[model samples]
Target: QPQNVIEKIVQRYAVNLPTPSHKVAQGDFVSIQPEHVMTHDNTAAVMSKFQSIGAARFNNPQQAVFTLDHDVQNKSEKNLTKYRSIAAFAQSHGVDFYPAGRGIGHQILIEEGYAFPYVMTVASDSHSNMYGGIGALGTPIVRTDAAAIWATGRTWWQIPPVANVKLLNTLPEGVTGKDIIVALCGLFNNDEVLNTAIEFTGKEGIAALSVDERLTIANMTTEWGALAGVFPVDEVTIKWLRDRAVYLARTQNRKHERINDERIQDLVRNPLLSDSDANYAKHLTLDLATLTPHVSGPNSVKHATPLTTLEQQRIKINKAYLLSCVNSRASDLRAAANVLKGRKVADGVEFYIAAASSEVQKDVEKSGDWDTLLRAGARPLPAGCGPCIGLGVGLLQDGEVGISATNRNSKGRMGAPTAQAYLSSPAVVAASAVSGYICGPQSLHPTNPISKTFAAFHAHPQSPIITYTDNATQTPPAKSAPADVIPGFDGTLRGEILFCDADNLNTDGIYPGKYTYQDDMSPERMAQVAMENYDPGFTKVAKKVRVNDILISGFNFGTGSSREQAATALLYAGFRAVLAGSFSETFKRNAINNGLIVLEAPQLVSDLRKAFKGGEEVLTRRTGWDATVDLVGGSVGVGERRYKVPPVGRAAQELIVEGGLENWVKNRIAA
Candidate 1:
C-alpha cells in the first residue's frame, strides 16, 4: 500500500497493532509512542493529572520535554510557585527541562534537535505543526493525552485525512511564507482542509524556501484548520540539519558524535517521501508568484486581504507586534529590520518585538538586526510567548487597532474583544508600524532593496543543558480500586438545550485566554467564565440551568487552540453533552477524555436553528427546547422531532462511564 508522508510517519511510530503488516488507513485509530512529547507552562496542570493517575515515576523520561514559555512575564507569586512546581516535577521525574525565557516550547524542540526529519513529535499545543518545517510529523494533543503518555508511554491517535498541496511558482520579492499562509486561510476560509493533514510538494518552489519560511507556513496550518502541514525532506532540509548540527556543536561545546555528518548522511540517503502512487483525499495547487503580501484581520484568520486592500482601507494601528512561535525566527527578524533600517515608527503606534527563542534573539543581535529594531522605536520583550498568548505588555487596549505576526487573532485572544488585530509577516508588521496603518514593506521606501537571503544559523548561543536522572529503587505504589458506579452517564439522558448559533466558535471564546494558566482555578470559577468571551451574558443564563443540561452549537465548534479547558469549562458549567454540526478533532478528543458527551447532528442543529430562529429569545428567557439523548439507540429527541446520530462506541462509553481517560488508565494500571 502506497502511503503519504503522514501515513509513513505514523507507521514508523505505531505500536501494539493487530496486524503484522503494520498498515494503517485514514480514520484508523492506532496506538503510538511518539519520539518526543512537549508541554509548556501547562506542564504544571499535566503534572497534577499524571500524579492523579497513580504514576509516581515517568514511564520513559527521555520521551518527555518540559518548557516554561507562556506566562513568563507574570512575576506574581502564584505564577512563580507554579513554575517552581513544574521544575521540581521535571527534576524528580528525570525529564529534560527548559526554564522560563528559554523560548516557546515548540521552537525549543527544533533548536535542540529533538524534532528532526522523519520523527514523530506531539505537543500539548496547537502550533506543534511548526515541526513539519524540518520533515517531522508534528501534531497537537490535549493535556490528558500528555498525561496518558507520561504514565504509559503511549496513546491512541487517529490518522487524519491527508491533503496534497503543490506549489507551482517561486514567491516574488517581498512576499513571504506568512503571506502564503494568510492567503490560504483567506481564500480557503470554508474549512476546505479542516481536521486534515497536509503534505507540500513542488520540488522547485519548495527548494526555494528557507527553513524559517517553511516553519512560518507550517506553523499557521493550525489557523488553516489542518492537523499537520509537512514539507518534503529535500536538500534544503538536509542542509538545515547539517548547519544546525554544526551550530549546536560549536556553541554548546558538545562532542561531534552527538550529531555528526555520518548520522546526517544516513537521513539524506534514506529521505522520507510519499510514494508516487499515494492517495490523497484532496489536492490544491498554489502559485507563489500570484501571491502578494497579505494580512488576516481584526478577529478572524479567515478574513485575509492583500496589503493593497488594507492600505486602501487606511486602517490605523495603535499597537504592532513582531512575535509568537510562528514568525519570530531569525529570518523574520532580519526581514523586519530590513524594512525599519532608517525609519521610525509613526507616532501613536507602539511597536513591540520578541524573538521566538532566546537563542534566536542572540542570533539576530550578532547580525545587527536586534539593534536596528531597537533604534526604530521598537520595544524588546523577553524571548518568550509574550503578547502572543494574551500575556504581558503590548496587548491591544479596547478600541485599539493592532497588527501582529502571531498565528491567531481570535476574539479576546490578544486583549479586549473590542480591540482589532491583524496578522501578517514581520515585514508587514514593521511597515505598518512605520506608516501607522496597515501596509507592506514597500511603504518604507528604503535606500537599499530588502534582502531575500537569510542566514540559517548564527553561533552566539548560551544556554545551559539541564537533564535529571531518576535512580530511585522504591516499589511502585498501588492504584486505588475502581469505582463501583460511574456517575453522570446512563443509557438515556434528558436536559434543556442551550443554543449558541455561531460557526467556528473558537476555544478562546469558550474558555478565554486570560485564565489559561490558572492551574488552581476551581471548576466553579471555570464555569463562571465559560463562554464569557463569546457571549458576556452566557454565565448568567447558564446559572439558571439545571445540572446535566445540554448545549447545542453551530458547525466547527471549538475551532482554535488545543486547550482542553474549552470542553472542561462547559462540563463544569453543567453541560452534560454538546451537539454540534461538526467539531474540531482536538476539541472532540479533549471532550471525550474529560468524559463530556459530544455528538454530530448537522440536520438536528439546522432544525434547531430554524425552530429557535437565532436563539435570542432562548438567551433572554433562559429557556429553550428540551432534549432527550439515547446513547444506546443513537438518537436525539427534541421537541416532537427525532434525529439520528452516530452511535457511541463501547470503548468511548466505557471511558465516559469511568469518568474520563485518567480514571480508565488508573483502573487498567490496577488490573
Candidate 2:
C-alpha cells in the first residue's frame, strides 16, 4: 500500500489487515470507512428497502447527505409525492438535505467543502468520480449498498489495479480538458480502463490547468470506464480553494474564513506523491500539443472526431447545451459566455445554459454573462442537474440532433430514442450554438484564441450567497462491521442469451432516467422498459423467460451512469446473470450487490457476437440465443460446447450467493 495513492488511501481507512500483494498492486478485497455517503432523489427507493429490513434509524445520520436533483421540478403528481417522501425522510432522520434548485450534488460537494484530499466518499451518481479532481476517493456504489452505509458507517471495497495517464506537455491555448478526455476515450476505447483506477500525473501538465479544467478531466473518467480519476493536491488546488473561500465571504457578506492554506494542508495525508518505484498495470503518455477541439458524436462518447473536420460532415444540430458537472464551473461558463457575447443563436437552434451550482449561477449574473446569454437567446435554466438526466428543458425531439457539454450521448439519453446527441467542450458547444452545426472555437473568431477571453469573462466571477453548516461532529462514528460471508456458486444457471454489443451500452439503455418520474413504479414496471432502447422487444423476451435467464454483451457493458435501478430492473425482468466481455466498475458492482451475477466471459461473448451473420453490426437485429451458464463449473454452454467463465472472485461470489449485499447484511444482523 505504499506506492499508489489508491493503496495508501485504502490502507488508511481499510478495516481488514492488508495483504502483501495489495501493498503494490490491486484486485484485493478490503473493507474501508467512508467519511460521507451522498444520495440524490433515489434515496426514497433505497429507504423503502432499508425500512423493510426493520432498521430503526440511521447509524450516523450526520454523515448521510441527500439531495433532490434528478427530478427537481416534479413534472407529475407521482413525482411530487416522491419528493415529499424524500423530504419527510430527511426531516425525520436528522440527515442533511438539499432541496430542489440546490445544484448538482457534485457541485454542492465542492462549493460546500464536503470533498477534500484523501477523503473516501461515495455517491450513487457515477460521476462521483468528479470529486477525484480534488484528490478524494469518490467512488460510485449501488443504492442498496448506500442504504447499508446508513446502517453501518463502513462498507466493503475491492482495491482496483492502478493505471497512470501522464500528460506529456501543457495544452496549447483553445484546447481544454474536455478535448484531452475525449481523445483518451477514443484512444483507450472504454475496455482498457474497465474496473481500473486511473491517476493522472505529470505535475507540469496538471499544474497548468485551472481547478475547473482538472475537474472536467476527472468528471469524464467515468466515461472512460475508470473506477476513479485522481489528481494530486498541489499549489493550484490550494489557491483555488482559498480564492473560492474569499469569493464566498464577499457574496455571503460574512467574515473571511472556512478556507486557508493551513486548513487545506491538514486535510491531506502525508506523502502526497506516488512512490517512485510504484507499479502500474498500464502506462500511457498523452502529448497535449497534439490535442485540438474534439467532439464525440451520435450515440457514444468513444466515437470522437476532430472538430476541424466536423464541418465537412455537415452535422447541423437543433440544440446546444452548455451545462452539466463536466463543464458547468465558473471558468467553463465564462469561456462559453465569451463566445455568446454579442452573437445571436442560429434561427432554429435552441441554446441552453445551466450553471452547475447556485454559486456559479450568482457568478454568471455578477459577471453580466447571464444577460449576455439571455440576449443571445439562450435560456438560463435552474441551477440543478437540468436536462443532464433529461429532467428539464432541451430534451431533443425524434430525429433531432443536440450538441451538449454533458457527458454520455447514449441513444435515448437526452430525449426521444431516435434523437442523436453529441458531446464536446462548452466553448465548442457555444460556437456550435451560433453556427447551428458542429464547429470548433476557432470558427467563432478568426483573430482570438478562445482562452484569451476566458480571463476577461472570469474577472467578475466570485462568491456564494449560501451559508455553510456543519452537522457531523468532530468524532468519527463507531464502526459496525458486516458479517463475514464467503459463499460459493451452488447451482446450475441456464437462460436464453440477450445479445448487446460492446463499447457504449450505458445504464440509461438498461433503465432510462427519463422515466424516473413515472407513477406507481415497481421492479416489474421498470422491467418492461429494460433495454427498450437497445432492443425494442427485450421486455417481451424477458417476460417469457424463466428464472436464471442470461444476458450476453460486448465490452464495457453498462458503461454509463450509476443508477442501481438498472440492476434492479434487469433482475426483476428475470435476468440471473450477465456474461459480458467486460463491464463498467459501477455497473458490475451494482449487479452483484443486487444478486444478479455478472460473469466475465470474453471468448463466450465474442463467439456470441459471431453467432450472428454480421456480428456486432447486427446487434439491433438480435433475437434470443440460448446459453447454459454453469457457475458451479466456472464455464458456460452453447450447443454442447463449453467455454470458461471468469472467476467472480471470493468477495463477489459471496455477495451473489447471499442474494446481494442487502440480503447478506439483513441475514447477518438478524442472526
Candidate 3:
C-alpha cells in the first residue's frame, strides 16, 4: 500500500486501540508506545504529575532520558532545586541522565544514538521534532502526557497529514540551510504547515546537504508549526551516525560501537521513505537557485527578509550569537570561522559562540575552529542552550538589538522583552558581528576596523556571573480569582470575546521563560506578564473582564515550548475558556491539565475573523463584542449567525469537571 512517511511510521508504532479498530490510518486517534521518551528542564513537571497519579515507578526507565539544559546555570534556589530533583529521579529510576551544561536534550539524544532512523521517540520539549533529522518519528508532548507515558508507557496522538516539500536544486555557495528555511518561512509561514509532517524530498536537495545542515532545517520545523520535519534515511545519514559513534568512542571514553555492517544494511534495505505516489495535503517545489540569504526579523519567526536589503532596514546589532540547536554543531562553527578567522568583531558588539554539545565542542577544539573564533574575539560560552531561552550569556539588555542563529526571534527571546532579536544563518551572524550590522559574508570588508565608540547602553551589572544565588527567598503561591465554577458542559456560556488574529501564538510570547526561572512567582505575577510581548496592555484588559471570558485566537495557538505556565497564566488571569482554529499537541494537554479550557472551534474562529478587523485592530479592540459558547449544543453564536463546532471531547470535559489533571488523578487514586 502506498503511504506517506507519517502513515508508515504511525501505523507501525501506534499501540493500544479501541475494540472497533486496531489498525491506524491518517487522522486516526491512536495511542503510541514510544521507544524512548526524553524530558529536560521540564522533567520535574512530569514527575509532579506522575507522583500525583500515585505511580511510584516509571513503566519504562531504560527508555527514558532526563536532562537539564534550559536555565542550566541556575540563578535562583528554585531553578537549582528543579535540576537536582530531575538528577535524583534519574539516579533512583536507573534512567540515563545528562546534567546541566552538557547540551540541549534533543541534540544530546542524537549525539548518543537514541535518535536513529525508524525509531519513535516522544519528548516533553517542542524541539523533540529535531530527531526527525535522523528519520525518527519524534514529537513533543505535554507534562501530563509524559506522566501518562511514565505510568502506562503509552500516550495518544492524532496522526497528522503530510506536507511533502521537494527541494529542486543545489544550494549556492555562502547560502546556508538557515537561509533556505527562512525563505521558505516567508512563503509558507506557520499557518500553512500547522499540524502537518513536512517531508523533504528530491535527490538533489538531500544530497547537497550534510547531516548537520539537515539537522538545522529539522530543528526549525517547530517554528513552522509542523508535526515533524523528516528527511528519508540515506547514505549520508548512515555515514553520519557511524562517524558519531566512532568519535564518541575515541573522545568521550564511552562504550560506543559502530552500527554492525549487517544492521547498517538492514537499515538501508528498510529505509523510511515517502512513496512516490504518497498523499500530501500540500505539495510545494522550491528551487535552490532562487534562494538567497535571509533573516527572520525581531518579534516574529515568519518575518523573513532577504539579507541583501537588510542594510536598508538599519538592523545593527548590539550582540550576535552563533548558538542554539538550530546551528551550533561543529560544521556550523566551521561556517562562522570561515568568515571570522582573522577578522575581529566590532568593539561595541558582543559576539558569543556556544556548541550544541560537549562532544561537538571537543570536535571543534581538536580542529582549531574554537581557536579561530576566540582569535576573532568571539566569547565562547558553555555547551547548552546558552541565552537562547534567556539563560545567561549574551542576554540582551533592554532596547538592545541582536542577530542570532537560534530558531525563534520573537520579542524577549534572548532576555529582555524590550530588546529585539533577529534570526539568521551563522555565516551571516559572523559577518554581521565583524561589520556591526546585518550583512552576508561576502559583504564584509577586510580593512574595516573595530568601532572605537561603544554603543550607548547600560552594561549588565552581573556580566558572566556563574554562581548560586544567596538569600533568594521563596514566596508562597498566591491565589487568584477562583476558577469560574464550570458545571460539566451543560452548555451555554456568554462572555466578551478577546480576539487575537495571529497564527502560531507561541508560549514564549504568552509567558516569557525569564520569569519562569525566578521560581518564586505567584499566579498573579505570571498573569501580569501574560502575552506581555504580544500586547503590553493585556493584563489590564484581562483584569477588567469577569471570569470565564472567552479568549479566541488563530491557528496553532499556544505553540512552541512545553512550559505549562503558558496555560496557567491565562487561567489565573480569569479566562473562562480558550477557543482557537487549532492548537499544538502539548498546549492542548497543558491547558486541559491546568484547568484552562481549550476548544478547537474552526467555524467559530472563522466567524470571529470576519467580525473583527485584522492587523493592529485586533489588539486595539476591547469591548462591545459578545460570544455565546454552547458546549452541549456544539455551536457559537455571534449576533444572528450561529456557527457549529464540536465541543471539547469526553476526556477533556471530564478534566474540566475535576478542576485539572491533578484533581482528576487524585480522585482516581481515592476511588
Tell me, by TM-score, which candidate is best.
1
Error of 2 at 174 (Å): 1.0
Off by over 4 Å in 3: 19-21, 75-81, 249-263, 312-314, 446-580, 591-671
- Give per-residue lDDT, candidate 1, residue 248: 79
| Local accuracy by lDDT, each model | 0.82, 0.75, 0.75
lDDT of 3 by residue, 1-671 (tens): 46777777876776534333344444444557788899888888788879878878877787788878887766689888788888888999998999988888889888776777887888888888888888888888777878877776766565665677778878755567887777777667637777877888888878888888888888888887787898888888888777765666666676564343455668877777767766666666777755666788776887877676675565778999998888999998988887887789998999999999887898899999999999999998888786898887679999999999999887877889999899998888888999898877656654322211111101111111111111112321111111122355545678888877778899988898788778888978988899987888787788887656788888888877878899999888888688888898678778877767776677676766776754546462454678898764456887897765444433445566777766665565555
- Which tens-of-lDDT digit does each residue in 555-591 have in candidate 2? 7788767777788888888878887777777787788
Question: How much does candidate 3 score in TM-score?
Answer: 0.75
TM-score of each: 0.78, 0.76, 0.75
Ranked by TM-score, top first: 1, 2, 3
What is the Cα-based lDDT of residue 133 in candidate 2? 89
Q: Number of backbone collisions per candidate, in order?
A: 0, 2, 1
Q: The CA-based lDDT of model 3 is what?
A: 0.75
Residue 158 lDDT (model 3): 55
